[model samples]
Target: MDIKLDAAALEAFLRAEFPQVAGEYTVDRLTEDGLVLRMDVAERHLRPGGTVSGPAMFSLADVALYLAILSRIGPQALAVTTNCAIDFMRKPAAEGSMTAEARLLKLGRVLAVGDVLLRSDGQAAPVARASLTYSIPPAA
Candidate 1:
């Protein structure tokens, strides 16, 4: 499949539409197949146990898939999450940043599906995996 937005374009789109989260995530790499997103972890992302919270992990997955969709369809903030399923596989160390590798498995006019694998900055094993579905609203 062809990508409508490249790394630079994706970065700009995120900064413009989602300013609050702009610095939290970055488009490290983008290609014809998928994109690599880096999450800048902060103290707020952790729980009392010094581990990343489920909500934080979920947010990363959601953003990754959403960005993946935008990378193909251009800046479409109307694309919203319709459903999601996430599995927390391993505990993330509270020491470092996390990364989510997301890919668009399918993209259509009304819906998009993708999965994200998340791990600590240097860990090889995934800390979580999320399957997400996005609803693309009709263009105005």
Candidate 2:
């Protein structure tokens, strides 16, 4: 699919449309079929064991997929996640950032499906994986 937004445009869209989470994530790059997003890990994202929390990782995956969809469909803020399933395979590193690589599996007229793999920076293996389905609002 053709990309409607680049990295800079996606970042601007996030800041303008969703300022609450704009600072938490960065658009690392936009690939042909997807994009890579980096989450700046903070103290609040940690669990009791000094590892990244599941919710935080889930947020990363969700936002990554959301942006991936927007990159193709333009800034459609109403596009919502209809279903999501995530698997936490291993513990993430305590320090540094986590990157989520999200790719769209299918982009139909009303629904988009994607998968995301999250890994701690510098790690070779993924810490988590997620599959998500998003409902795209019909054009006005």
Candidate 3:
């Protein structure tokens, strides 16, 4: 499918529609299948062990899929996640950022399915993987 929103447009849409989280993530690039997203890890994103928190990783995966969907379907803010299954594979580094490679598996009239693999910045192996399904709001 043709891309409806590029990196710049997606970022702008995030800032305008979801200001609370707009600063937490950056759109690194968009590919033929999906996009790359970078999450700026901060102290607040860590748990007591000094590693990235599960919730933080989940948020990265969630937003990555959300943006991936929006890139193809335009800024449909109402589109929401219907299901998510995540696996935390390894520990993430305490410092730097995390990158989520999100790819759309399926896009249909009412549902979109995607997968996300997250890795700590500069790391080789994925720290976590997630499969998500989103419910797309019917066009008005």
Q: Per-candidate RMSD vs. true structure?
A: 1.2, 0.6, 0.6
lDDT of 3 by residue, 12-131 (tens): 999999999999999999988889999988999999979999999999999999999999999899999999999999999989999999999999989999999999988999999999
lDDT of 1 by residue, 42-115 (tens): 89998997899999899889988888898888889889999999999988978778888898889999999988
**Which residue segments of model 1 deviate by more than 4 Å?**
none
lDDT of each: 0.87, 0.96, 0.95
Could you tell me every candidate's TM-score relative to the true structure? 0.94, 0.98, 0.98
Number of backbone-clashing residue pairs for each candidate, in the order shown: 0, 0, 0
Candidate 3 Cα misplacement greater than 4 A, ranges: none
Off by over 4 Å in 2: none
lDDT score, residue 55, model 1?
94
